[model samples]
Target: MTVFAAEQQFHDAEASLPSHQARLACRAGLAQTTAGVAPGYIQGNLAILPETYAAAFHRFCQLNPKPCPIIGMSDVGDPMIPSLGTDLDIRTDLPRYRVWRDGELVEEPTDITAHWRDDLVAFVIGCSFSFEEALLADDIPIRHIEQKVRVPMYRTNISCAAAGPFAGPMVVSMRPLKPKDAIRAVQITSRFPSVHGAPVHLGLPQSIGIADIDKPDYGDPVRIEPDEVPVFWACGVTPQAVIAAAKVPFAITHAPGLMLVTDLKNKHLAVL
Candidate 1:
């Protein structure tokens, strides 16, 4: 089915449900960033690698569950991610893509058929954005959304476990929350292990080796409140870091804030 055609088949109600049409709009190239897409639906970070390294990469994700939780994975040469939806195709589902070669990002394309190969495995990792629903449900204000910017992501000194050709330090995405709301966020997010679960650390960025909070390694930086503490979570960027460190010949990832909208509801990912 055409991407838009397939989406219209789903039931999406804005008042009693999150608008699937609005969600489809973002996925159909209407929005440049997904700071706020399907408010109560799960979003993901994407990574695709050639078959030669897919086995080791899968193991790497299994070993490092926090940063690389695999929500959907496709067979080599397959664009479908059945676990995520009834008819999801990795190639055209996302609004944007980043093509990397030998660890260097060479192009940002809306469609990747020119780069698709017979030996590639696509991975859809859970995004912390998945938890924004819970956070909003409980009334935690998201600064980036209010400002309409990408969530700030940073490279940390924390190192990830090495697996064959995949190894690198963890990358984290930060959100500033009032002390009380931060605790609630921790409680709300803990239920979704498929997306990231729980805060890795809070209050101090330097302790985790983040030198410049104002300058993020990826995504745009958001403002921090003096009354709020910056909370950090293990991010999907960790895999990109691994790909860069390993210097893989070729790889593809979603452009930072653009994501694949799946048929799986955010409620389905909740532990309770």
Candidate 2:
């Protein structure tokens, strides 16, 4: 089969699994971008660090809530975050993980069990995937999902508020939408603040230091139709950028598009 055919097969098999099943798929070595998968479930960006950096990182999220809203966190050394899902295992639940050492990405592992440490703490930051469900429900088109590609994300001129040893330019995810849909998307996503609600900027990608909209810093790029304007949202991936800049001795983050699928329903996070 062709690569596109295989990808479509993968998407069909994973896209509607219940939250726990999705986690099981990930734990079993099924690595794929989590976008549009397990719809209506809340997905999160994962970040793990040693206990020594946990407090500082928590402060970083608190300081920059837009890109780092805390959804669920694990107690030091424990992989399970019971609040997110009784069966969720941080070390193995995500489809893929980025292992960092001294601010350098050293590995992208399907399982972090071998790299797990007794002093590590896990943080689950709210993901835009949750809000995409809201957008779809509103009939707003999501180019990346429709194209079966990972959403395009870019680093911006905007800087996140810093905390001890954690600071970097904010990263944002982009989705192109028609003007009317853009307005409605803003309204729809605004109700889910914990999930990186609403567009931080719309149109003018160059204004955010993105010179070529077709080339993204992370994830796959989708075409922006002539009638559509690119809408940007502060992304949970911002932590990875900060981690790279901070050069923490050790760190782990979810691969850009592969998130931690949670038991919590997307609706549970809506402000309405």
List model 1 lDDT by residue over 1-272, tens digit each: 88886666543332223433544454466647665666666678889999999899999999999899998889889987777764567877677899999989899988787888999999989988778777887789988878878889888888888889998889988999999999998999899888789988899899999888999998899999899999998998889789877889999999877887776788889889
> How large is the C-alpha RMSD of every model relative to the true structure?
4.2, 6.7
Consecutive 10-residue window with the lowest summed lDDT within model 2? 12-21
Best by TM-score: 2
lDDT of 2 by residue, 23-109 (tens): 989999999988767778888988999999999999999999899999999988989998998588998899999999999999999
User: How many steric clashes between backbone atoms does each model show?
Assistant: 0, 0
All candidates: TM-score: 0.88, 0.90
Task: Please report the candidate that would top lDDT against the real structure.
Answer: 2
Error of 1 at 242 (Å): 1.7
* lDDT of model 2 at position 209: 88
